[model samples]
Target: MTSNFRSLPVIALLTILSLPLVVMYAFTLVDSITDAEPGSLIPSEFTFHHWRFLWDDTTGRGSVWIATINTFIFAGSTAAIVCATSLTSAYALSRLNFPARRFFLAGVIILHAFPTITLIIAIFLILQFLGLFDTLIGVIMVKAALELPFGIWVMKGFYDTVPWEIEMAGVQDGASRFMVWRKLVLPQVQPGLSALLIFSFLSGWSEFILPLVLAPGSDAQVLSTYLAYFLLDDSLEVDFNLFKSVGLFYALPVILIYLAFQKKLMNIYGGGSKG
Candidate 1:
């Protein structure tokens, strides 16, 4: 009772501070779906014309549908590849002692330290040489590779939190090392794994530079690139409503995903194995 009373003021203050931002965002969404006048916050009339392009290729160039599909392919593939390789490599690094293990971990940090732009020229040439230039698969591979260092480090920390006793107990119970890791150890780090997966997916989903530079043109464009077209359109007047609508569309998946996994995400910072 005393603690609740003490926290009431903080909670109230936070609510007060967040209220305007929330209202503004809500109005932004409303502005997209309604026919509002220039510089007017209130809607004059409601219309679905803003969303019409989502279903039909009203824009003679093409709809964002293909780019949406390509985005899913790239983000999904990047997340899966990063998760799989990160988990195994993290487990190995956490549990096994080998030559240059520490050095390799340091190397991962060094690899991620450099801005990706620094390697753009080299990557572009390499992709061109490998016949993967301007391709979705190529982008997926690059995104996965770039995300791997972070994923590996995160998963390694989670793996460190898992008690070795758990693996030993599984081994003592006649479980193979693979089975022990699969059935026993992995479950303990569910929070970190879930966090990494979501982050990797969102990273790929929101990736702009890599896709823009490596896979430019309509054929390989993703949602991030598609959003650019709104600003780059030849129209004399920029349609803020249409741009916001598409922005909302592009953001929906990420919002839904975070909401769906919000509960699990808390476990990321929760206490790890005791021993």
Candidate 2:
């Protein structure tokens, strides 16, 4: 009786915490199917009008498809670049013997602290000089830069956590440094890679400011800009339901990626044997 009674407070606290989430989810579930009015908690008439209207591109103006593709290109490119660069750079930082290594790591730290948004104009100028402004490559470059430090830091720690003996054994077995790294180091650090990959994906997938500034052209506009268009139509504006649908579509890909990676993250972090 005493032990069970001790659990009461925990159960009570949990109920209190869950109340708000339950309410919010209940509201969201209802709103998703309804012609939900602005500033209303509950819809007066439940309907799927918003969902249908979202696909009504008979007017040839739905930016959903455009935004989706742009987001994929941006997120995919950033992930690939960040992963490739961070992997090589981190391996060096962890194992290489060189002067100014600490200084270089410090430089990476300082670079992370500097907000990319603060360098918009300077980046624009440089991009313009390099003929990259208003281009997907320009946005990709900026996003990659922003994601680099964290990726490097995370991968470096991962490499550091690995046992040196694994590499040593491989080396004694007549393996080259590159060969041992390719076979042993990479396999051990995969979870850390998963962790970094998810973070890198998130970094650029939802990025709005850099892409907005860099890709101002209609051809280059992404999901963030696409949403901004809906916001600009004040007189002919749609309701919150439409906006939510916009969010739903933009979020679907990232959600899918997260779901796919979430299990991997758990497996990695849970101390499951390395694949």
Q: Pick the candidate with the highest TM-score.
A: 1
TM-score of 1: 0.89
Residue 4 deviation, candidate 1, in Å? Answer: 6.7
- Judged by whole-model lDDT over C-alpha atoms, candidate 2 comes out at 0.79
Clashes of each: 0, 0
Please give each candidate's TM-score: 0.89, 0.85
Q: What are the lDDT figures for the candidates, one per model?
A: 0.86, 0.79
- Quote the positional error of residue 217 for candidate 2 in Å: 2.5
Clashing pairs in 1: none
- Looking at model 2, residue 70 earns an lDDT score of 82
Q: Which stretches of candidate 2 lie above 4 Å from their native place?
A: 1-8, 14-22, 36-41, 52-54, 58-62, 233-235, 266-275
Candidate 1 stretches with Cα past 4 Å from truth are: 1-20, 235-237, 271-275
